[model samples]
Target: MVANDYQYILENMQKELETQAEKVGELTKERDNAGKKIGALEAQLSETKVVLDELELIGDDATIYKLLGPVLVKQERELALATIKNRKSHMETELKRCSQTVNDVSKKIAKEQDNLRDLHMKSQHVKQALMGAPQQ
Candidate 1:
């Protein structure tokens, strides 16, 4: 009866470990995706800053062409500046959101790792008991 109980416990622990491992895999993917998004946003922000700086250096008489799809539409300098600044703000906000998501997913992955370790230890103890050995 004791051996059967130990066997049952080991089986249950194995299932739980598998589930936790799957969860960790999912969280890791999410974290990676968020990191990629952050990188892309940062690159866009840098490009936008450069364009904004160039606009500032240009004289008021300089004509600015805003790209609309495949067409370059003539736009006032002030309007172009406003549009670029708004895009930069939006990208910044998205970057912050992605960063927070990455942090949250990382914490979840750590917790799942801890659970997996505990489950592994329990499984080892059960196996030892089944073998008629003293469980250390």
Candidate 2:
């Protein structure tokens, strides 16, 4: 009866370990995706800042062309500047959101890892007990 109970516990622990491992994999993927998104956004933000600086150097009467879908429409310099600024702001906000998501997912992964380690240790001890060996 004692051996049976230990076997049952070991099986259940193995199943739980598998589930937690799967969850960790998912959370790790999510964190990686979020990091990639942040990198892309940062690159875009850098490019936009350069454009904004160029716009600042342009003469007040300089004509700007805004790409609208498949067409390039003529726009005033100020209007183009405002549009770029808005896009930069939006990208900044998105970057912040992505960073936060990465942080949250990282924390979850860490906690799950700790749980998995504890489960693994318990499973090992149970296995030893079932085999009638001293558990170290």
Candidate 3:
């Protein structure tokens, strides 16, 4: 009966550890994907800023052409500047949101790791004690 109980305890702990490990793996993947998104957004934001700077250098009356599906449509410089500004603003907001998600997931992963470590230690001790016990 005692051996059976110990076996049950170990099995439960093993299952719990597996579940925690899987969660950590998932969180790690999420963090990595968010990081990639952040990188892409930063690159795009940099490109847009460069265009915005160039647009600002142009005079108000200067003609701007917006490429739409291989066709260059004539656009006013002011309108072009406005569109770029809006895009930059939206990208900045999205970047912040992704950063926050990364931060939150990182914290959760840390906590889960600590829990897993503690559980592993406890399970090891339990196994050792069971081994030292006299067999029926």
lDDT of 3 by residue, 32-116 (tens): 9999999999999999999999999989878899999999999988789889999999999999999999999999999999988
Question: What lDDT does model 2 reach?
Answer: 0.90
Provide TM-scores for the models.
0.90, 0.90, 0.94
Worst 10 residues of 1 by lDDT: 127-136
* C-alpha positional error of residue 16 in candidate 3 after TM-score superposition, expressed in Å: 0.9
TM-score computed on alpha carbons, candidate 1: 0.90
Ranking by lDDT: 3, 2, 1
lDDT of 1 by residue, 1-136 (tens): 5556766877888898899889889999999999999999999999999999999999999999988999999999999999999999999999999999999999999999998889888878877767875433
| lDDT top scorer | 3
Off by over 4 Å in 1: 2-7, 133-136
Top TM-score: which candidate number? 3
Model 2 off-target regions past 4 Å? 2-6, 133-136
What lDDT tens digits, residue by residue, belong to model 2 across residues 1-136?
5556666877898899899899889999999999999999999999999999999999998888878899999999988899999999999999999999999999999999998899889888877767885433
RMSD of each: 2.9, 2.9, 1.2
